[model samples]
Target chain A: MALTDFSAEEQIAAVVAGETSSVELVAAHLARVEHDEWNSFLAVDRERALARAKEIDGLATRPPLAGVPIAIKDALSTRDLVTTAGSKMLEGFRPIYTATCVARLEAAGAVIIGKTNMDEFAMGSSTENSAYGPTLNPWDLTRVPGGSSGGSASSVAARQVPWSLGSDTGGSIRQPAALCGIVGMKPTYGAISRYGLIAFASSLDQVGPFARTVRDAALLLSHMVGRDPMDATSLEWTEPIRVPSATRLDGVRVGVIEELMSDGIEPGVRAACQSTIDMVEALGGTVVPIALPHAGYGLATYYLIAPAEASANLARFDGIRYGHRTADADVLLEHYERTRAEGFGPEVKRRIMLGTFALSSGYYDAYYGQAQRVRTLIMRDFAEAFAQVDVVASPTSPSTAFRLGERTADPLSMYLSDICTIPISLAGLPSLSIPCGLSEGLPVGLQLAGPAFSENRLLEVAHALELAIGFDDAPQGVGV
Target chain B: MIDDAITRHVARLARLGLTEDEVVRMQHELSAILEYVDQVQGLELADIVPTTHAIPLSNVLREDVPTPSVSAELALREGPNVTADGFTVPRMG
Candidate 1:
């Protein structure tokens, strides 16, 4: 079998069994990345990856991910590689320190093959906002890979790499993974340290992993999660979730969220997700009807709250600190204005303005305050739902991968793409998207979410469902 | 709908510059978004407490031990204009 054909775990096994060397694996992935057709990777660290692979080849016993090639979203800092976060503002800015999650991945023996593309500053639902241009879907070249983790999802789907890391502020990881027909997990907030991650919306952002299989995602998450002094919000390390190879859903109570299934969902997507629920029933799991009453307001609430946080978090990028600066300004204020205006894309600027307006003196109580209260209500909705169910199931997105430039003209339409995944982020729950089936020849993602720190149960349930669904649809003719 | 004055003010606060056409477009878009978000005003939130964070966290303090930090040279390496001592920005008005 081709090296790219092996699962990440199988690749590690191959290295351990002396059937394949780490150098061979890394070189194969690097070559694929170099000749990528999906525009997935932003920077390929060929030398560093080969050097690391060589070192691993010399080791008598390999680490868990000893020879596996992993692509990183440009959002995460790498000490040597440039971390652009898909924006031109920090186009060539190389970090002095690596993100804690990445540091852990390196220590686990994973080869950092390259950095993937994303929506600029992780802002948009489609990667068109990226200064580097949009990443095309491997399944359909005209369709988007989704964002702001589009490149990571597309890279994995295209088989440029077996697995990759993506950051989710508000469905950035899961939405893209769903579009790409892969598995992506957004752990509970604080599950992974965010030290070297350039802040977008501090309260909402969580680093996650994207892989072809649920088990691979679990493995990646296990290596990445731990507490850190640098990130006070980091959660204490929990025992890694072990997904049984033979997955069974007996006694698993799957909650069917009435709000998530409401109107605007495409007909095919609804059918695919409903079938997955039926499979859960056949596997002896009970499907309970649950209500997230405030879920209707999630889109609006997220728009206000996330942007409000982003407005404050992004204030640090005033051109003097780091990143792009304007050359034509003669005074400090003009310089600040020119730098930001020239650097940020329309979506980023729009959010900043909306956030500033909402948080302004007279409007804070009306916009920002109202959103926070609604957020509490949304959290309560989840708490109440989980009382009757072990996990909540929904379509990861309202529709499958949209054609590129389809929704870019209308901001509201773009925001609606995340309606299904936003509430979980607001509630700080662990959620993952796994391919259930196809919608109009495109992959449909079945989202599974649980209360905070319930990643173990969530992953187990998702694995069982993935096995039952047996979705092995790979994008055709994508790799080298 | 938000007026051009308010939109411009917000842009200033955000440190972003807008053209005349952008201001008009932003005013309309912001107004529409605000109208949608105004749905929250209809909810009976008198008994609801606002949530600043999803997971409740208190003041997280770390030990006051000195740890290695990025060197000054490395920190300023990405700056647009840097001198030996610090980053150089345009002169203040």
Candidate 2:
């Protein structure tokens, strides 16, 4: 087997066992990434990666991911790489510091292959919002890989890299992972420090990992979590995230959230999740129907809330700052308007306008305020559901990969793709999407979510189920 | 539904320069999204305490002490207009 196809753990063992060098592993992945079949990567530092790999080969003590080639989402800042969140606004912008998540990865001896493409500022459901272009799915070159973490998910799925990092703010990680047939996780809010992560919606954005295996996801995430003095919202967590070795779901309770399972879900997706649920029951786990009444309103509430925060957070992209500037404007007001108008794409402008209206006088109470209160209701719904179940399970996405441009024109249709995943974001929980099985020749994702700080338990349950399902995650019609 | 006035007003507030066509596009798109988000407008949320963030915590203050920080040169590295140690912007009217 090719070293590029090996699991992250196996790759690390190979490096440590003197069977191969870090340079070989990184070079192999770099060659694969250069194919650019899916337009997955936005930036790559070949020189640095090779040099870093050489450094790892000389290490007396091995770092956990020593010499392993991994990809990072553009949303996370890598000081050495140009970190544009797939927006023209930050086209040439290079961040002064690396994000806490990427910094942690480097410290653990991983060679960052490149920054993956994402939705502009992590705004869209598909990576189509990327100024460069959409990242096509590895399974079907014509289909979208899902976004704004589409590139991260697709890169791993296509085996360009064993694993990568992607930020989840409204299904960016999980949806793409599901659509691309991989394990994608968004840990609990504050579980990972947001120190250098470019802000989308401060309260909702959390950095996570994308991997081919549940255990690999667990391993990648273990090194990334922990409090950072650089970020105020950071939290401490149980270190070295370990999945239970016991591969049984005995005595576990799986709640299928009613709101996410129906209404817009493809029959194939529903059937795949149902079969996974049956597997849960077969493994001595009990399945229960859990109701989340407020979840139906998740999309609407998120549109108001996420954009409201985004409008505030994205205001920093004035012409004078690091990103793209307008040469046409002389006055400050004209400069601000024209620079952003020229720099940002359509989706971003729509959100900014929508958010400004929501927070404007005579509308704040009706829009942003109501959304927050409804957010509490959604949180309460999840809180109550968690009280009755160990973790909730649903299809990570409503349907499998949609052909590129299918829903791009109609923003609302694109927004509907996230219906199943948004409420979990609203509630701020540790959730993961593992490929359960194939439907209609495309892979389907079974989303498992738990209460805050339930990552260990969540990982254990997902690992057990992933073993039971044993679905192959290799992309067809694509060769590395 | 929001009209063009609100659309233009919001665009101005958000500091976005929209072409005549974009304003029309934004008007239609914003109107549709607002109508969709209108679902939350009728909910009786006045009685519920709003959640500003998912996790609840008081102050997130850290220890007050001087430490090494990013240099002015590094901070201004990506500035569109910059001097040796500071950013340069258009003069105020």
Candidate 3:
């Protein structure tokens, strides 16, 4: 098998065991990056990646991820790399500081080959929202890979890089990971530092890893997570996430969220989820029906809360500092207005308007405030469910990869794409999307979530279930 | 439907310069989304505390001591028209 085809853990092991040089491994992966064929990468500086790999090859002693190649979503700053966050507003904006997650990964000896594409400001559920272009699903080129982490997810799925980092505000990581047929995780809120990530909704955004296997995803996450003094919300994780040695899930309680499964789910997705439950039972894990009564309102609450936060977070894009400056502005206020008006796209504008109205003087209490209360209720529902079960199961996305331009016309239809994953983001919990099996030649993800800081337990259940399901990660012999 | 006046007002608040064509479009879009999201107002849970952050956190305060940091030139490198160690912006008339 090609070095690019090996799991990230296996690639790292090959380098550590002197089976393959870092340069060779990186070169093999770079060859698979396909020169803008997938629209997955914003920048693929082969020269820089090769030079970095050579540096790792010459090291006196090997580092943990010595010679491993990974891609980062453009939302995270990378010091010298231009991070557009998939928006033309900040087209050539290069940050001087690197995010805490990127810094930690680099310090542990990983080579960043490129920055992946994403939806503008992490707003939309499809990479079609990207100003540059949408990232195609590697599984089927006509379909979208999902967003705002589509590029990152597709890159990992295509084996351009064995693993990558992506941020999930509301299912960006998990949905794309599901659509693209790979393992993606959204760790507990504040479990990983958000210091350098371009802020969307501060409370909802989380950076996590995408990998070919759950263990590899866990390994990459373990390297990236820790408290950052820069991000006050970041917490020091006390528990060690170990690669589970046991292959069977014994006495694990998997709570199936009834609300998520009932309405608007595709039949193939439902069949795959039911099969997952049966497989869990086969592996000694019991399934319990969980009722999250308030989950029906998660979409409504999220639309208000996320956009309200986004309006505030995105207000920094005025022409004065960085980002696009309009040529027609005569004064400061015109500059701010015209710059933002011209720079932001339609979806962004709609969201800004929605958020501005919601937070406006007379409407704040009825919308944003009420949404926060509903958020509290949703969190309480999860708290009640977690009390009975160690982990909860749902479909990461309602369906597999949708065709490009399928949901773009109607904003509400596009928003519904994230129905299954949005509630988990609202409550600020750890969740993972691992491929269960194929549904009509497409991958379907079975989502597993746990309460705050229960990633180790979630991983334990996921890893064991993964082995039992024996999912074929390949999509019609597509990549590496 | 959300009125044109309200839609324009919200657009102004957002500092977004929408064209008249866009104003009409945004009015319809905003009305539909707002109508949908207005479901939150139906809940009678005023007593429930709002969650600002996912995890409960106590503020960590420290001495406001100056630390070594990035140089002004490097920090403003991405800013438009950096001159004399500061950003150049249009003057308010």
| Regions more than 4 Å wrong, model 3 | B62-65
lDDT of 3 by residue, A25-99 (tens): 889888888565679998776888899899999999988998799999999999888899999898988888999
Evaluate chain B of model 3: give its TM-score: 0.84
lDDT score, candidate 2, position B37: 84
Tell me which of candidates 2 and 3 scores higher on DockQ: 2
> How far off is each candidate at the interface, as Cα RMSD in Å?
0.9, 1.1, 1.2
Give the per-residue lDDT of model 2 (tens digit) for B1-93: 777788888889999999999989888998888889899977888799999989877788888889899887788889988888688777654
What value does the lDDT take at residue A469 in candidate 3?
85
For each model, chain A TM-score? 0.98, 0.98, 0.98
Report fnat for all candidates as fractions from 0 to 1: 0.81, 0.87, 0.81
Q: Measured by C-alpha RMSD in angstroms, how accurate is candidate 2? A: 1.2
lDDT tens digits, residues A81-157, model 2?
89889999998788888998888889998899899999999988779999999998999988999988999999999
Question: Which ranking of candidates, highest DockQ first?
Answer: 2, 1, 3
- For residues A1-480, what per-residue lDDT tens digits would candidate 1 score against the true structure? 579867798898888888999999999888889998889989999998999999988988788897799999999999968988888788888888899999999999999999999999999888989999999999999999999999999999988899999999999999999999999999999999999998998889999999999889998898888789989999886676665464788899999998888788998999999999998878888999899888999999999999999999888878897888998699999998888888888888888999999899999998899899999999999999988999999999999999999999888899999999999999999999999999888999989999898989898888888889999758777543
TM-score of candidate 2 relative to the true fold: 0.98
